[model samples]
Target: MLWVKAFHVIFVISWFAGLCYLPRIFVNLAMEQDGAAYQRLLLMSGKLLRFMSPLSILAVAFGIWTWWFYSFASGPGWHWIHAKLLLVVFLVGYHHVCMRLHKNFVAGRNTKSHTWYRWFNEIPVVLLAGIVILVIVKPF
Candidate 1:
């Protein structure tokens, strides 16, 4: 169980690292006027997404293993776990949205400004903070 928790944390951090940076790449892509730079950023984004997708899957898998096999959220008064799970769902949706955004970028149909992406880039940070607080503080 401890090992499961450790791996879960490790993969979660790895996944978050990509989540935090992908949108910053989008910001660069949006702001880039040079065709070469835009293509370079797109290549970077595609590679990052490919790498992060497995991390996200492993993170969620280990998380569910901890919860189901180890009964991490089994007892009463585990409302914080419920809240965290909801946030996790939202985080997954956000990841999907990023994929769609990347597709839009690849299709040369992106209309959002760099400023919008800058704001979008902060989303995972806030979600991470909320998740950590819920897990550590368990403030229901």
Candidate 2:
């Protein structure tokens, strides 16, 4: 169980790293004016997304295992767990949205500016902070 938890944390960290970095790549993509540079950034985002997808799955799988197998006793103060799960769901949605955005970039149909992507890049940072606080402090 401890091993599972450890790997869960490991995968979650990797997923978060992807969540953080992918948008930065999008920022570059969004700003890129040259066709070659745009294509390169699109390839980079696609590869990064593909790499992160499994880590996201593993993180959630281990989290579900941790909840069901090891820590099912949800009583008072466990609302944080619910909140964390909700945020995780949002994160998963965000990941898929990034994939769609990558597709848009690949099609040369991206309408968003680099500034928008720069702001988008900060979203995962905020969510990561929220999730870490909920998990570590379990503050309801």
Candidate 3:
């Protein structure tokens, strides 16, 4: 159970890093006006997808395990659990949005923009802060 908690925490951090950084990368990718920009974005995003996919899988697995295994009796970080779940929903949407962006980048279509991505990247940051607060403070 402690091992489960450890894994859950580690994966959650890694997952959050991936979630945050990928969108930041998209900011640069979005700024490209020509196919070169698209090419760079496609390559970088593809590489990042490969690296982050496994972390996401780990995060989801440990998160579910933590929930189903320890949630009720121990009251184990329920606020964090809830917040992470909400962030996970956002992650799912972000994942699909990344896919959409990937397709567009591969097809030589410009994504949104650095300006758009600057604000866009904050979504995960806000969610991360909420998750961290819930985990640390458990204020609910």
Candidate 4:
């Protein structure tokens, strides 16, 4: 069971790796106006999305299952769990929005500024920090 946790953590880290790198792709995607380079970035985004889709879902499922398996007795208080859940919800929402944005981006419909995209890139940093703190500190 503990070994299962290691696998879960590995997948979670992989999913976060994809999430972190997606914004860098957005930077490249935003810079391109057209042609083969733009097409290349678009294709990269699609490939990354395909790779991440299942891993991200498995991360969520494994996270929940691990919690239910080990922490079902309720010892560290529900506050920590609640906070973690909220952050997970935010992650899921962000991923969904990113998927929609990627679709629009590939279609060349999104004309967002590089400035906006740069700001958006910071979101995962903050989110990952929050999640890490909740899981690590478990601050009452």
Candidate 5:
């Protein structure tokens, strides 16, 4: 169980690295006027998304394993776990949105400004803060 929790934290940190960075790449993509630079940023973002996908999967798997063991073995008053899970679901949805936005960029159909992506890039930070607080403090 300790191993599981450790791996969960490891992978979550890895996944969050990409989640926090890909959008910064998008910010450059949005601002880039040079064709070569735009294409380069697109390649970087695509590769990053691919690399992080497995990390995200592993994180979720370990998280679920930990959650199952702790929630059931301990029994009751795990509302904080439930809330953290909800935030995780939203985080996953945010990842999906990033993928969609990447696709839009690939298609040369992105309509959002760099400012929008700058704001978007802050999302995972907020989610991560919430998750960490829930896990550490278990605030009801």
Candidate 6:
């Protein structure tokens, strides 16, 4: 079980690393004007999104393992877990939105400004803080 927890943390960190970096990539993608730069960023974002997908799956899988193995879902002081799951669902949605935005960028149809992406980039950061607090404090 400790091994499960350790791997869960590891994969969660991996997923969060991608989540943290991808939006900054979007920020660059949004701001880039040069054709060559655009192509370069497109390649970069595509590769990154691909790389992150499996990490997200592994993180969620390990989370499920932790929940099932530890039975944390049925335990007291776990309302925060429920909330954290909800936040994670939103985080997954955010991930898909990033994919869609990538598609839009690929199609040359992106309408959003770099400022919008800058704001969008903060979503995961805020969620990370919320999730960490919920897990550590287990605030009801």
lDDT of each: 0.95, 0.90, 0.75, 0.85, 0.93, 0.91
Return the top candidate by TM-score.
Answer: 1
Per-residue lDDT over 1-140 for candidate 3, one digit per residue giving the tens place of the 0 to 100 score: 88988998898788778778887778877776667666776688888877777887888887788777864424543545666577678876886787677677677676476898789788877877876776678776
Decide which is better by lDDT, 2 or 3: 2
Clash list (residue pairs), candidate 1: none
Local error of candidate 3 at 69, Å?
A: 1.7
- Per-residue lDDT of 90 in model 3: 81
Each candidate structure's TM-score, on Cα atoms with residue i matched to residue i, is 0.96, 0.94, 0.82, 0.93, 0.95, 0.95
What is the Å distance of residue 58 in model 6 from its true position?
0.1
Candidate 2 lDDT over residue span 81-111, tens digit each: 8898889988999999998998888888999
Q: How far is candidate 1 from the true structure (C-alpha RMSD, Å)?
A: 1.1
Give the Cα-based TM-score of candidate 3 against the true structure. 0.82
lDDT of 5 by residue, 9-78 (tens): 9999999999999999999999997698999999999999999999999999999898788654343667
Off by over 4 Å in 2: 71-73
The segments of candidate 6 whose C-alpha lies over 4 angstroms from its true place after superposition are none
Q: Any idea what lDDT model 6 has?
A: 0.91
The lDDT-based order of candidates, best leading, equals 1, 5, 6, 2, 4, 3
| Candidate number with the higher TM-score (2 or 6) | 6
The residue-by-residue lDDT of candidate 6 on 19-95, one tens digit each, is 88988888998888769989999999999999999999999999999999766686677788899998999999999
Top of the candidates by lDDT: 1
lDDT tens digits by residue: candidate 1, 7-52: 9999999999999999999999999866988999999999999999
> Who is ahead in lDDT, 3 or 5?
5
Candidate 1 ranges with C-alpha deviation above 4 Å: none
Global CA lDDT of candidate 1, please?
A: 0.95
On a 0 to 100 scale, what is the lDDT of residue 23 in model 6?
82
lDDT of 4 by residue, 45-124 (tens): 88998999899899988888887887663665657877888888999888887899899997779878777888988888
The residue pairs found clashing in candidate 4 are none
